[model samples]
Target: MPEIKTLAGNLTFTECPRWRGGRWWFSDFYTHAIYSMKFDGSDLQKEVDVPSKPSGLGWLPDGRLIFVSMKDRKVMVRATDGTVSVHADVSAYVAGNPNDMVVGSDGVAYLGNFGFDLEGGEPFSTTNLLRIAPDGTVTVAAEGLHFPNGSVITPDGTLLVDETLGNRVSAFDITPTGLGPRRDWAVFGQPPKTMHDDVFAPDGCGLDAEGALWIADARRGRVCRVKEGGEILETIEPGTGVFACMLGGEDGRDLIMCCAPDFIEHKRIAAKEAELRVVRVTVPHSGLP
Candidate 1:
């Protein structure tokens, strides 16, 4: 593990961190805004305001910013001139909030969502992994996912999704029409039997150059660098609950983590303890975030 350092602090809750065009960009749930800042946390700017709350972030081939409007269950796009519009609506296919997403090289975005009312204490259920084409066509990419959250696309075109409640990372081959059959990329243990079972609840993740994944273990309050077959290469205890992470810097080796005291909606909405932390690692980033 490398030395952990704070890059930014006093946020409400940060998610969907990304490094692009020489700056760090992320969504603050309680603040209802997206922010960008330099590597050292200087030049901080609020990039956009998303009233429905934003969760995932990505870019189109033509440079438009596409993001998940979590509450409305829609994917919204921002143009270079700062025009925002709904790109695709996924409310017809999901029951809970759409969380994280990974846009493929060809401009197709695969999105994940919470299966039930997690904060409301509803019974756990499964949801679909959705595919949104560049033309705004919405379809189901995969199904029966247990709270699909953070996702990444490998150089070889494999989509790896972190199933937070499943206790596993699921993989799928990115095909022309949609995704291939689902398989386990990494399994920390059996699928969680209930909400309180001790498990490795992976949240947001980033892929390293060596094909390993740096996963925010939401339930453990730590980040684990894991290999394909379930081997954890490194464990980073940042002393807070990490919900999302990204690998990006001038050299593409900086691991940026989204940290907070906890993930409860009421607690996070009432406080400003969320932070962004960084740790430099040996491996650079690999593919789509």
Candidate 2:
């Protein structure tokens, strides 16, 4: 077993972890803030606050910070001068609040959404992943995804998306116009019909140097190191509800796990019980955040 340790606590649901500019950066959902810290958990800093609640985070080529504003169904951009602006409004194409996002090196972003009223206990439904160009033009990159959550683009230009309710990681070829044909990168089991069903619910994830993915198994309260074709190479039970995992650090072997008691909106907002945890791994991180 790999030794796990607490990096920081007193958070209310952390997500969208990325290792960039020599720090571990993440968003605390209920707190509505994004934070960053050093390898040993020192120098913790609250980078910014998003009143609509922030989720996934990435950087544009020009150094602007772009992130998901979940409740407002928009993508926000923070410039070097700390000015925040709406990068894109995707409410017209989405059925529910937008969630995770991964911006490619070329400055194009692929975004995901819940597909239903998750906290309100609505039934599950498929959704689309929207592609936002550098000019902020929004288009449906792909459709029929069951709760497309965390996403990453492989070095070879393949986009891998975690379908939380679909029990699989879907892949698509990155093309000039948009995405190409869809394929299954990894399948856990049959897609769960309801939220209460036995499910893995892959949330935020990170890619490793060997091309495998470290996926946060949301409903299972664990993190899984999975290979292509649905093979589980390893598992790490963080002893809490692990919502997101990212491989990053000085050498990119630090697996940062976001832990919380639960994901209920009200419950998380009521207390600061969430934590950021970490464990060391062999492979360095690879691909887009």
Candidate 3:
């Protein structure tokens, strides 16, 4: 394990860390801005602002950037010239705010939603994973997911979605018919038996060279490396809130983590306390997530 180091700080809840274009890109929920900087943390640049706050980040095969506008439930696109526009309005399919998304090699995106007002302390419910094709058509890719949070697409064309409230990572085969029926790829903790919930939780994750998952469990104040069958291989202490993560760096061994004290909506929307930390591991990353 490599020593964990702080790469950036003074953010109000950073999520959706990504390694792209030779830099680290992430979003600050409270600051309403997306930022990018060198791996050493220099040349920090504000890439964009999302009045509704941003969550997930990805890019199309054409090199256009896509980001989630959490509050407005919209998927936004940023062009090469820095022009931001609405790619699609998802309010009809996902009543709750959308979260993470994994853009496939073909440019199709599979995204998840909260399914409830998490910050307002509302009751939980099962949600759908919205599938948006390159042409901008939106449809339900999969459903009955309990707070589908982070997700990954393996080289073999399989989709693995982390059910944060369900205590398990579910798998689906992407086929012409659509995403196959859900199956368990890994299981951990004793998740609530019901479908409506949040915080039963494994918030964000990354896939390794050997098919293992590096997960950040916000509720548990820790991060864990586990095999597909749910065997815990390693763990990282959470000095603060570890809400999201990404695997990046030259060797793809850098474990980029999104940390904050907590994710209380009201609190995060008002202060600056989030950070980005990096921990290097033996295995490098292996897929689109």
Candidate 4:
């Protein structure tokens, strides 16, 4: 177990954290706002107000911030001067709202969607993984995902996407144009839970220097480290409802986690009032951006 910290007190549904420009940037889905702060949780700044409920945050090769606009199922880009624009409109491809994302070294942004209205009283299996080019072109990378969530590209450029409702993480080779053949990188249902998210249940994720996948197990309240061959190496039990995680801190070796132990009950009463919390653990490898 690691020591947890309140990066910002009682955030209204926070998810998707990324490190950029020597700061930690994240989003509050209900608040529809993006924020940044120092490593010590100081100098918090409201970077932008994205009305579509921003979730994931990424960066372009040229230093522009790219984020997922969930309600619209689109990817948006924020320039250095803070201008936001639609990078890709993926409504036609993704079955539901976009959730989490990861940017590749080739400058392409890989995004996932909610698949169904998890909190809107209607649940259906319809989600897809999408890719957005540097020039704002949108294309369907993979389809039929139950609820695609967090994702990351390997150092060799292979793309890994966590199919939340599917209970498995899938891998695909990234080409100059789009994704290649899909393969199961990891699956998580041997030990089943009655109240698990219908999909994979894995949410926010990142890549380790040793090519391992660090997944935030939302329903299980733990961070699982999965080997490339789909083996569970280690698990960090937060003992609370975990939402997301990112490798940050001074050396990028500190694992920063976003948790809300009361999210399940909170969502039932009001989907917008979910709390935000974070924790840190010292690890061996720094994470991918």
Candidate 4 has what TM-score? Answer: 0.88
* Number of backbone-clashing residue pairs for each candidate, in the order shown: 0, 0, 2, 9
Instruction: Please say which candidate is ahead in lDDT: 3 or 4.
Output: 3
For model 4, the stretches where C-alpha displacement exceeds 4 angstroms are: 190-200, 262-287
After superposition on all C-alphas, the RMSD of every candidate to the true structure, in Å, is 0.9, 1.0, 1.8, 3.0
Q: What is the lDDT of candidate 1?
A: 0.92
Q: What value does the lDDT take at residue 174 in candidate 4?
A: 82
lDDT of the candidates, in the order given: 0.92, 0.92, 0.85, 0.75
- Give the per-residue lDDT of model 2 (tens digit) for 173-249: 99999999889999888877776553578899999999999999988899999999989899999898999999988
Per-residue error for 246 in candidate 4, Å, reads 1.0
On the 0 to 100 scale, the lDDT of residue 117 in model 3 is: 81
Give the per-residue lDDT of model 1 (tens digit) for 75-137.
999989999999999999898999999887788999999988887889988889999999889
Per-residue lDDT of model 3, residues 1-289, tens digit only: 4588999988888888888888998888888888999987889999998999898888999999998999899899998998999988899999589989888878788899988887677777788999988767799998888889888888889998888888889999998646888898987756676544334377888888899888888776678887988888999985777988889988898999998888787787677877899988889998986
- TM-score of every prediction relative to native: 0.98, 0.98, 0.95, 0.88
Report the error of model 1 at residue 18, Å: 0.7
Rate residue 68 of model 3 by lDDT.
94
